[model samples]
Target chain A: MTRVAQISCGTEYSGIQWLLSDIAERVGIELVYPEMALSRIDAACKEIGLRAESPSLNMMMARAVSTLADPTIKGALLLTCFKCSEGTIVKDTIRRYLSDRSDMPIISYSNVEKPKEIELYARLEALATLITRKALLMREKQEGITMGIDSGSSTTKVVVMKDDEIVGEGWLPTTDPLKSVDKGIEDALNGAGLKEKEVEAIGVTGHGRELVSKHVNADLNLEEVSVVAKGTALLSKRHKGDATVIDIGGMNNKLILTRDGIANSFSLGGICGGSSGRFLEVASHRLDVDISELGQLALKSTERHELQSYCMVFGIQSLVVSLASGVKREDVAAAACRSVANQVYENQIQEMEMRPPITFVGGVSLIEGVKKEFEEMLGVDIIVPPNSQYAGAVGIATLVSGI
Target chain B: MKILVYPPNSLILADLVERAGHEAVVLMREIGEHVRDAEIDAPPINVTEDDLKRALRYVSVEEPAGLKGRIGLLTPLLDKAEASVILSDAPPTYGCMGCAVADEFFKFLIRQRKIPTLEIKYEGKEKLEETVKGIMEFLVQLPKEGEISEKKG
Candidate 1:
């Protein structure tokens, strides 16, 4: 396992250290707490030359400086508790200090006691993928007959591609991951009118990638960010200088900044049903319409109502209030769509620069109400990549073929 | 009844807790007594190096001495707390306690103390009204007499 340096204070006390270790273990990476004698901490403190009030702050600066000085260290995790003013300053200073000097990739977190599982998985998995599969991430094209599966939280998706073109794809709402993967890959093969053994390689990505990949003995188990970028690049084929890829799935949302076919930076949204397709699912069900018809119903509404909170429960509370006041169903649908788009913007997009040639991929991108709202809010035409919803499966299929 | 408010010393959370007829056990109350004492030479910094060293029992020894110092100050308030009103994920500007490590440790220790704690995740702009209402409801619902009663046999 590749060792990633940990530069933070008090993760052990808050019990986040064990959770970090658990995530690192799950992702097949290791957390390296840079250490020396407690007495030598004074010297480490002196070497960094920081006079921060807390000894922990000083310790973090010392560890950060030492880690940056060491060239062999390929990755580091810089962290600070969100509530610490001094720690934020220290975190920013060291972050810039390291970013300027080191070639190593570093992930920063402003944390509380309970860490979000998906966020940790994405970040550590990104680090793990970068360290392990740099060449695959750099590969520009797909080769041979490869099958890729996205065993996501709410849905399982598979795409079978030959050379550079997709021959077949399968998508199903997820229940049991093992069963879903079994069915999805079979469906894709059936759609392509090909036997399962005909596939040259298999790659998997998403929340359920580990289990599914282990079951299949896959070629590549890549992270969502890299695969999504590759898939978006393949499908978009637009004027491809600097572009942003947005994929809002059933459980959470992702925004990736891309340069050519590769990811430069990415952010996954906080665990909120409001920022995801599940919110729309609930909205569509409550409105007594099929999920497929929600976009058309939203388009018919002349008036726009707003939902107050980005939490699904609170957003639904707002939705209920609007309905109680006898708001038209069309208007409520529009509000629900607009609320989802707004939350995605506020929670995810605002954190990253929205480069032009913004491609809206994933199942949510198919909703015209969402696409229209994204366009209206950003004041730019959003590109809905062809087979946008199949981006992940297609992406992994492309990546595994490169290997 | 004494209710501890996190940020360790937020006047706002303290005031709201007090409005529910409970004494607010905040750092300022403990530190007020520390500043008045003649034994500790450090005026503003109430906890001495030895005092900070003594605080090792609260958190791991691997932690820095400064965080230990901060935890030392909150110990008195923790001892007195019967219930707590903690607004989590608030910006550093909200409390300005300086040490983020100790900030987390304070919350962890309070939770370990097993008081009737109300931890509201802080959301600015959109959910302030609801959060305040949540705090009020939580404080009102806390057992007036003492710890929650055991079920009768």
Candidate 2:
């Protein structure tokens, strides 16, 4: 009998475990439940019926392969479910564990099917073959290239993704809303190293979607709300769960609520510039400082002031008045962060009935101080992903890999 | 327990109010004729000079019922109203502020006399709920509308 060890994370005694158990049950292989997995190998070893001799990372792998050393035992498999973040990391980690060992074939896979009826035996049988050789790309070749150009009043963003990895992405200040979109699209295609003929379809979004569609042909044109929601869903799929996305653009803001992978509702801001990016830009000009270091300066604020007004005009006036009253400039900048957060909370979040794991994006996400204000008010941890500013582009690029 | 809200004829606002567990009676002036053609609820109320005295809890163009007409009919209804609330959308339209009528009526209801209340800008249902909750909290201490006396110099 071939000893097969299958490990599931965050799914123990849950839906996934039951599915794996059913699969193992049908395959006629006795399962050695490790109970819990502190690390990837531990879980693998337990499911394979091995003694926990030495739990070190290297030792664990050695034992895993040695147990599989017998020709009777064929391979190993790592299983993940839809919307499982830890599963992705753990699956990769375990794959790395058995990568060099040719004797024990190991493969990682995820199932979005209902848990009650998982075909573990058939899946593992197929995985067994894939492990021995390179898996051929079964997907069809590019029929044509499709593009999603997102142009706002202030910024232009373009993304082209194939097979769900970022193939090409571009961003530029929207000097000319109409023309910059075309330029951004060209830049994105060049970065991807693909020609316009390769594109299959085109999608346009943002306030200028209509204008863009008028300029360049598109397969589909969606509102900024739909485009952003679609983009956010693609990015958050790797780490699943309900997430409130706060996009703080230069001149406006957007609050999107997503659950399981679908956007439930969304709200966008008006043409107010009190939000962080535009605020910092204007503040830097008034204070004669660099915008990049504004976050660090705000951190050194000796005193904090409250900006009470919601109107941008009144807010600017209030800032000037406070500065004239001898308030430290750093403190004044800090107050702007507070004001932005308050506006987000009062107008965007609380008004829209948003929930957390709130992900803050947009160009201003680079500013640490503004993020801190959000964390403070929401009283929950805020997650800012890598390439925070380029998330829109990254989201668009990820579309190629997804169905 | 029953409160009517008029928002700036924006479906987005009605959607927000519905999400907040409130019965939002949307009054849309533009589509009133179509709604009338469909022959639903009470005939479309007509906008008139008398709507100035009414205090609305919410106002928006999202409601298919004529905003002006509804306000005109509600002037007397507001007199019998236990309480009311109003929120205006961005770039407040003349109808939102009851500008087609007299300004003194709004001043009396919102500022000086404070009969009901009027809030300019996006007075979303979230704020409306907060106001409702506040009123509920003060219910025990509130004097009867007629029994309570306004301070006079």
Candidate 3:
């Protein structure tokens, strides 16, 4: 069993001590509680120099620091009761410290005295996936023909990759994902000038993945975090050691931080599609331009217009108000892009300490206006790698190639 | 007789449901089996491979992966629920499991479920006894025996 350090306070009293260890051990992970060094506790606290009062809380932090010293440990599980305000602060501190100091993946949980079993299971499962699947996430190249279907909410994207390069691709609106992937993959296969028999493996990802995977018989099925990280690694070699990926999709957004091509930490959220590709699609349609024309149209405008930048509905209302007031279509498009970029920055980007070189992927990434806004916000050129819109499909396909 | 306690995972809510003559369909009931089952080997996650595949019909893929895994495990209980006791504004501590993302989304599914539901906000722990009393009252009102007998008959 792979061992991960268990760094926490109050598990003994919470009645979940056995359950936590049981869950970890059950998942082929032995919880590595730092060997008791009662004398070393104060010294460990002094080393980090955090001024926290609770002895156990201090010890939890110290144990966290000590876990960093152990090479046998593959990952860390930090736990604290929901009532422990001090524990929460220390938990975040240790998480940041461990992340900044080492490549060990970390997950934290706030539990009640008798925390539910499923919650623990899910958290541990996610942690296990990070450890057990590291090789797949860190894979640098593709070996054979692999088809990846990214069943995103707004679009179904499919890609056919031969060896290490993309041969054919498909993109279409996603209404019924199970049905969409059939035609989508067919189009890609047709473009590749190959029969279905030539394809070796299939990988499915994104929200529509399970439905499509069932339809297409996928060999590799994974969530977007690791898949996107792998896809970005292939697209750009600039930050092979440490990098960040931004993917704003139809309904939500993903901000992923990667170390050595494996996603170490990520923030997944995009409330109301306010800061996503859908907003741009809606605004572009309103402006009587194709979604593909939005980026250039936004670039053409010099006038700065403000739209409600938080909620999608409010943003659309602002869009209506701007058009009613005779704002140029180009200007309105620019405002929409700016609004999306700003919301993404606020909601997702700010969640991680973005380590560059940052690669932008997803349908929204193709919009030069969104790219410019992100570049302006970060003051660094955001690389929208070749075929950025097909990131999920490319990601899944590349991963499936290994199998 | 199945009362799904909203913001699930509360021993107290489950107990209240029991006191009101109903079995509480809960996260603990659903996930606990997978976790503690001796036959289910180590790396014992709640959502099995099949469970995740089946859950796709319930929640969208766009949800956080955690949410998807949870919705899968929790929905079976949701489907069995004849009633639900929903708690709001209470910090999800010491129980009130359903009140917590996976927490929000699962509770949302229960809310949307076509079942008799009672919504209550926890004033505070000092008032928890009163809150429990209110929850007990709602659980009692559920058509437990009558509905089951009617369907059976």
Using TM-score as the measure, the top candidate is 1
Q: Tell me the tens digit of each residue's lDDT in model 1 across A1-403.
A: 8878888865543435556788888887878867644445566657655567665677777777678656556678877765556776677677556655654656667665456776787888887776677667767677999999999988999999988888888889899999998899889999988899999999999889889999999988888887888888988764256788999888878888766677655677755778899999998988899888998999998988887776788888888888889999989989999999998897667645588989998888888899999999999999997889888998899889987
Error of 2 at A133 (Å): 38
- Model 2 spans > 4 angstroms off: A1-146, A236-239, A271-277, A391-403, B1-71, B74-153
Candidate 2 achieves a global lDDT of 0.52
Model 2 lDDT, residue A264, Cα? 38
Model 3 is docked with a DockQ of: 0.02
lDDT of 3 by residue, A1-403 (tens): 8889888764543334667888877777889887656567677777767846545566687788788778899898887665445666777788788898888878767654345675576457656767888877767887788888999889989899998888988899998887788889889999999888899999998887767777787898887777887788787754368888998877778787888777786666633578778888888888889989999999998888878655677888889889999998889888899999898887657645788889999888889999988898999989999988887788778788777
Write model 2 residue lDDT over A1-403, tens digit each, in one string.
Answer: 2345554332231223445555655545434422322345444555533432212322333334444444554456555443334344444455545543443445444533233242344344333322322121111221234566777666888877665555777788898887798788889899999988887766666667677777877655544443454466555443355567888877777776654433434555553577646776776666566766766767778876886675566876787888888988888877777788788776557534456777877777767778888888888888777655655554433332222
Name the 10 consecutive residues with the lowest summed lDDT in model 2 chain A: A133-142
**Which residue ranges in model 1 land beyond 4 Å of their true spot?**
A1-3, A25-69, A83-104, A116-119, A238-242, B1-153
Best by DockQ: 1
Which residue pairs collide, candidate 3? Answer: A26-B42, A26-B43, A27-B43, A207-B61, B7-B97, B7-B98, B7-B99, B8-B97, B8-B98, B101-B104
**Candidate 3 - chain A - TM:** 0.83
